[model samples]
Target chain A: MKIFGINLAGPVREEVERFLASNGLKLEKDVEYTAVAVCREEIVGTCSFAGNVVKCFAVRPDWQGAGIAAQLLTHISDILFSKGITETFIFTKPENGQLFSGLGYRSVAATPQVILLEGGTANIGRYINEMVREAGINGTEKAAIVMNCNPFTLGHRYLIETAARENEQVIVFVVEENRSCFSFTQRLNLVRQGTADLTNVIVIPGGRYIISANTFPTYFLKDRQISVYQELDALIFARYLAPAFNIRIRYVGTEPHCQVTNNYVEALQKILPSYGVKVCLVERVKSKGECISASRVRQLYEKCHWEELRDLLPPCTYDFLRNYPNPGSQANQAD
Target chain B: MDIKHPAKAGSLESNDIYVMVEPSSEEGIVLELDSIVMRQFGRHIEAAIKETVTKLGIDNIRIVAKDRGALDFTIKARVETAVKRALEE
Candidate 1:
């Protein structure tokens, strides 16, 4: 058998789709690289990696236990290492957990239908421990909030303020993924600046564990799969993140616009409670009888509506926007 | 010797082992090993890895080994290859 890389488009793509479909799997659109093992020009096994997360693994039943899967995985790992990505994650079915476990993949979280596994240089335990150490977390009744905060807005500030007032300590995790309009560093800095006044609030990077491309690949996914990914993401938060920081309550702004955010909030509500964490839905703050949102702020900024944008954002965010050169051109540019 | 970058060698197959080596922030060698025969030969495999790394004079590194019943010689070779690759400029 020969294992080689295959482009995601063309005849090879069709063969992979057919092979995966025959094995009760569908190709996710986010796959960046794929490798297939072929025997006599027939696809025997395949694996793929997208942004450090590995998925869409299928080995023909007749070829199972022939070490084709291991070979495919090694190919993917080589590609990832060449790209300088040390951390890797995989989403697979529950039954195949042992197979991957033997290959050095450790279980991060698992549900009935799907299981999240991670390998390579970094793992969740070490990540959380490092974060806890750096943040200087104390044994207080802590609450949690995870937000992308594309640009820190008044709405986000309000949600954080409410959590800070209610809980003894509020751990705000700024999403570390750089897929937003603002870069991760800019977003993280804006959050730290915005919440600098709250004595009990500690802002930290969400790292690769929270709402990342690996944990929640919300873009270009079917509606059903979005819910599954959301649940998996939520389970990671509940089972690992919350307990590590002693966070008993999670605060989220009620989503009235984005269906994806609504589903995520619903998933959090459904999963966190069973894990001894309560979900608090804070009514979104409004400006002039309209709900204030980051997307709205982006729109106003794009339109150069400084007067309107001024009221929607906090002073820190507004100042940052005013000083930012050509903010609109930076939209959708990943850092 | 120092591991300047994260590097890996070998494959996850029967009678083989996968070795990953990276520079560690702290001193000393940090090893994480998983083997099918861990209950039987875990100590022997660990000794092989340590001996190979020590011979290479790598003092501060992190090694992750997933063994599928590889012999001591195979383990040493994979570890040596991975450490050397990591040391490459």
Candidate 2:
């Protein structure tokens, strides 16, 4: 059998579809590149990758024991590695997990039936290293704070300022996923402007590794498996990302209202210390004895509580709230 | 002893290993080992697999070990299970 790369078009696409269909799988439209293992010029096995994620991987039953799957994976990973995409993910049944694991993929997340395996040795480590190099910082007392900052509020600013005061350098990883009411770009701009006075605080996109859909699925929505995902995300941060940056401390605002956020902090506490990263929860900034939270700002926006929102947010956030129409109004309108 | 049928044990879970055992007509044990810790402890891991196979008295079989940083005990237990399952009457 021989392996060759094929574009997702024409006779090769049809052969790929038939190969996948034979194995009770279907060719995914989202795959960017695919490699096929051919025997007698017929596709016996197929593997596809979209960016770093492996999709539509299958081998015919007759060719399963011939190591065709491994060949296909090696081909795809070689191409991905050449393109500078080392960290990859693959989804497959629990039974075929050994086939992938034999090729250096480690299980990251799993259900009873399906398992998600990461195909790189140091994915998070590479990301943190790249982030540090890009920022060009080399300080022993570096700390970090990961925040969504739907809209940067005084509480968020207070956390950053506190971190900046305690550490020589503070890396603020704004969650880059655009799943909130405000887009990621908007949240990032608000965070930058809100903390412009803090010289030690360096803001950067968290990319797809921090609180990512693969690592932390329930960032905005609540789910039964929220705690599980939270622990995994925290573990990734404490064990890999933190050390790559020489981060000694992680600052998080205490969550008096959100159980999900509080649970996440608890998970961080359970794992971070073992990895030599201290978890610090600065109390949320309060106004008139009420804790300030981004949720409260979102709630105020829904109620058009401009006066109350002004009390909770910093001047920049207040100005953004005043000028940008309330997201609630936009949501209320027919699409 | 010879593996009468193909069988698998353990998982590809983090810090775990998966072992697949199949019947083979070869004269001696044939083992294919892969691991995340292959660079650091490949020899030790292979020795553990061979030791387990020897202790189980299974000499003629094809064993595939997909390791994800499992400890010695886990490796032994999984190898034992796969061999036993493959040799089931």
Candidate 3:
């Protein structure tokens, strides 16, 4: 019988329950994999674990070759991982060797009725890079790249490259906690990784002050900061970042990518002039007769338009898109 | 909560910055509470004062706060009472 739903009164239920009892395995509560799979009206296999690891997984003898075992093992392992069972196992009859070979049940020292399932942790390094107090750039012509870059396309690279050529230093201050698709740090790192070759560009966390504080202006709490505190902050960036390094210019893209950021550039252009910082607004980097903006790139990403993106992005950026598990994500966040 | 108390009279410590009531600095007088508050709360106190100074204004004089763990509210009240005493001057 093809393994399917779990009906309590059916032959499969009794056998599954018997199998559970025989193996001394019990189901867990509130685990998505356990709850979802256990309640399924169709169940072709059985697996159980007590603590945070899977004890065993067995597809019905008749349904073994169809890869039902792999499905069950994946579901069961997913549950065990949630329960802190980083190592999982399976126990089964040795006579059915062929079915086990192709299935995910990697055979470890197996007894007559047991097979150990390998619980593996794939590439899952998700921690933020440690921010060392000393590792960042000290001073130079502190050029800040005010861009959403959305996902840091080739056009962004072209603009950044041009900015680097004309200035002694550059810092890309990413907007934090944006509701856009890629997060602040994600977008920041994309720029960092993409721009690693540029000797002068530094990535600084702008916090939300410049980003969302303007959106809801009332709660900035540092109200007087508008005059003195921010003046002091800008002074800190000036006194410490510029003189410490020798920064004199800031490079930004010309308008119309995001209307919100257009206003941002206009304001910075006015205030920055007094601080002896000149703003450089570069023309939009274009590919195949179209201007490369986050919005246009996002639309292409969502539609998986790789060919169009190829012409729009630089070679390094094109590689990032090509290597990205999912490309053509229609998204833009640097407003 | 009303926290009015008998104003303590003592000599203002030297090396500690102080001021006599003057007409010019009346718009605002931001004192560095760093010497008093620095050992305990450090930088967090600077932020607490911005909040404190805004609510109390520059009326409060002789703010000799021996701040250990005083929050924004305490700083405001202490400075307000200190100014209230100088108002009698």
Candidate 4:
């Protein structure tokens, strides 16, 4: 048997899809690199990776014990190392946990349907330890909020304010993935500036462990699988993040329009409480009977309606938008 | 020797080891070793790694070694190669 890398396009892509289907797996659309193990000129094992996360891994039933999966993983690791990605993650079925653990991957979090694991140079412990050291979080009655804040809005400030008022310390995790209109750095800065008045609030990047491409690839998953991923994401927060920071409550704004956000809130509600962390869903702050949302701010900014946006956004966000070069054109392409 | 970039050598096959070396903010060497035979040969394997890194005149680096029952010579060679590759960049 020989293992080699293959571009996931043309005839090779079709063969991989057929191979994965026979093994009860589907090809995730986000996979960037694929490698296959061929025995007797037929595909026996396959693995694919997108960024640092591995997906669509499988081996023929007869070839399972022959070390085919290990060979494919070695090939993928070489590719990842070449690209300077030392931390690797995999989301797989619960039963395959042992198989990966033997290959030096440690389990991060797991739900009934899916499990998350990490390997290579970085792990969740280091990520959490570094954050804890930097943030100096020692209090026990702290609350947490995770936000994308495509651009910080007045509604975000309100939720953070409510959490700050109720808890001894409030940790605001700005989603670090750059899939939104505003980059992660921009969103993080806006959240930091917008909540500067809340002395108890601490804003930091959510890192790869939370709502990131590795943890929750919402853009590539189906509707049913989305909720499972949401549960897995929430489990990580409840299990690792909350305990490390001594966070007891999580604050979220009530979703009025987006079904995905609502599902995330539902997942947090279902999982966090059992871990002793309460989920507090604050009502969305409204302006003139309409709820203030980041999307609304984005719409007005795209139309260059500063008069309307002045009410929806905080002073920092409004000033940033006013000085931003070609704001309307950039806002039009936002997710 | 200074590790200018993160680099790795070797593979995860049986009787093989994967070694990764990168620059660290903290002083001295930070080594994390995971061997299948860690219970019996963990200290010996760690000694082989530190001896190799020290011989190379490297002072501050972080190394992650995942061993699948590799021998001492194999570990030393992989560590030296990974450190060299890290410094070359």
TM-score of each: 0.90, 0.58, 0.41, 0.90
Instruction: Please state the interface RMSD for every predicted structure, separated by commas.
Output: 1.2, 9.9, 33.0, 1.0
Which residue ranges in model 1 land beyond 4 Å of their true spot? Answer: A9-11, A212-215, A218-220, A257-259, A323-335
| Docking class for candidate 4 | medium
lDDT of 3 by residue, A124-238 (tens): 1110111213236553346666566567787788888897887677766665545566667667778788889898877666542233212222112223222222232343333
Between candidates 2 and 4, name the one with more favorable TM-score: 4
Candidate 3 deviant stretches above 4 angstroms? A1-135, A212-246, A256-258, A315-335, B1-89
Descending-DockQ candidate ranking: 1, 4, 2, 3
Q: Write the per-residue lDDT of candidate 2 for residues A90-167, one digit (tens) a residue.
A: 756678787776766776655454565776422444446667788787766789999899889998988999999988
**What's the TM for model 2?**
0.58
Say which candidate scores most in DockQ: 1
Q: What is the full ranking by TM-score, best candidate first? A: 1, 4, 2, 3
lDDT of 4 by residue, A180-216 (tens): 8878888899899888888889999898889732246
Report the number of backbone clashes for model 3: 28
Q: Please report the TM-score between candidate 1 and the true structure.
A: 0.90
